[model samples]
Target: MKKTLLSLLAVVTCAYSAPALASGGTEAPPHVHWEFSGPFGTYDRAALQRGLKIYREVCSSCHAVKHLAFRNLTDLGYNEEQVKAIAAEYTVTDGPDEDGEMFERPARPSDRFPSPYPNENAAKAANGVAPPDLSLIVKARHHGANHVFGILTGYEEAPEDHPLADGQHWNKYMPGHVIAMAKPLSNGQVTYEDGTIETVEQYAQDVAQFLAWASEPDLEARKRFGISALIFLAVFAGVMYRLKKAVWKDVH
Candidate 1:
């Protein structure tokens, strides 16, 4: 019995420690309060807009939100003309013409965000590893928003014991404590028109929120529907109870 208990303890320890070990003793991401967290939460339009700016100015050079369409900007409070203007900024490759030749055209609201590179090989050649698409990144990563925020702000000097290669960077939240991407955000890197403080932490937080919204654009609607359903159920339950009392009162 003692041996069996010891075996169970070993298994639990291994299961708990394996992730840390795999990540080279990387620390867990810190919790961040998000506007869209609770059941009554909704995406902040201002923050989403700011995040869009960051992605366009900084992240768009490498990463693409391929799963998102220009039309989807409406969810961020952009109007029809505004969305069209934004879409026009990008060039998209379209279908073959009558002569069997693909043509380039200004992107429309229906078009997906184009990748920076023409192909995977080009992206890999440029960045070593092709940057992952940001469309579903929030849903893809564990503790999505917080993890992303941690990574963006986690860069620091490596300890004497841990050396890094030429292209590698040290990040407190990164697995293995080594990352290929350098610190991307800097103080005052992007100017904000809304008079929001322009800092690395603020940028990280805004972009994380934006990515979260992107991952689940219907989050607000879904929550609203759920709340309505619950209310309806409660009302129906109450009405049914009263009707039962009325119908069975005489018999009882």
Candidate 2:
């Protein structure tokens, strides 16, 4: 009878603990297939360009890619002249003048991408929480692309019993299913010159990829080099094996 009671108590404890375990903390974001996921993977230049557009039109208002330079856009298949033209679009504040006052000037190719807000306080004042700098966000987060992708698409209605704080929205993938930022994308949010569908999912995927590239700009080149080195090692090993066989043939 005691064993039966203990077993019943254990089952009830597990039943109660299951929901708590599932929803108690920041949930792992859903996995999504990425073109740049594997050793041989490469970034899609077209997608990066599209993602840049989305970032400029939507995310730039809040989040900032402060470390990525305008010149880095060249990795997205942009030429020098095009990069210069793109860089000219944004103005960033420069050093103090003769009067000891800071001045603003047009951004140059060499300049780091400017933050949307001048400082952390300003960013926080504008949006309750200061938006995170996205420069190394991909590297900073585990399963970075998937996490960002999931967050972008995870906003949804909370269950009836789930309570949310004021100014917070429900995001199943976020910690406690609560987030300060609202859904930032919707259908037809951004029009693609290439005529790709303007969808939240598409935007999330593209921008996530762009962020990945920003985090590891040379990932493709590095992967290529790694592949070349592996090929050379295999060929060298075969040659060495054959040479050994030849050298030992007489002894055998």
Candidate 3:
């Protein structure tokens, strides 16, 4: 026990003394109070629809959501007919007929969202850096939606002392404060159907929430199951407690 205590103390001392490897230039991402944050939270369908519009009209040019299918839009309060119409807006490559030739067709509800660039090389050639797939980005990083929201709204001018690399933009929330992508959102960038204010912050929050949904499509169902399981466990525990009390009461 003495040796174990000493060893544990030594380890704790080492951990405290060790230098953390960190990017010194970046600031922590700003936190947003999201509607779908907690276990019982649910998504606002109106915000999600607006977010989809932002992605389709603005972010789609450079970013791609290959993991998302057109049918998934139904979760954003879109009906079958509306989803089909939205899907038809994009053209997707299709297989050959009897001739075994590839063809292009209007994307169907079943089709995955088309990538903006054909390949990584193509994306790099076009954008100088490969644009990341947004399908799971909100869940991919620490702080999830809050981090993404910060990135979208964090652009600013660099101070004179800090020089940014060519093609790199200063993003307050980005590690090293240098990001390849410029600020994507602006005031009035997306006119919401529900007449929500069109500010960069609003756009960022909505889009981040939408990305979170994409990352966890079954979040609501999963939470429901968790609640049901907890209830079942509680009932089981009560029954077990009662049985124990009844069996042991006479002896005690």
Candidate models: Cα lDDT each: 0.92, 0.89, 0.89
Give residue 54's lDDT in candidate 1 (0 to 100): 94
- Cα lDDT, model 3, residue 98: 77
Q: 195-231, model 3: which lDDT tens digit per residue?
A: 7999999999888889999999899999899999999
Clashes per candidate (backbone, < 3 Å)? 1, 0, 0
lDDT of 1 at 93: 97
The runs of at least 3 residues in candidate 2 whose Cα sits more than 4 Å from the true structure, single-residue gaps closed, are 1-27
Q: Which window of 10 residues has the lowest lDDT sum in candidate 3?
A: 16-25
TM-score of each: 0.91, 0.87, 0.91
| Predicted structure 2, TM vs. truth | 0.87
Model 3 alpha-carbon drift over 4 Å, by segment: 1-20
lDDT per residue as tens, model 1, 1-252: 999999999999999878768877678888998999999999999999999999999998988888989999999999999999999999999989999999999999999989998988898788877888899999998679998899999999999998988878989998878888888999999999999999999999999998998899999999999999999999999999999999999999
Candidate 1: regions farther than 4 A off: 1-21
lDDT of 3: 0.89
lDDT of 3 at 31: 75
- Which residue pairs clash in candidate 1? 23-176
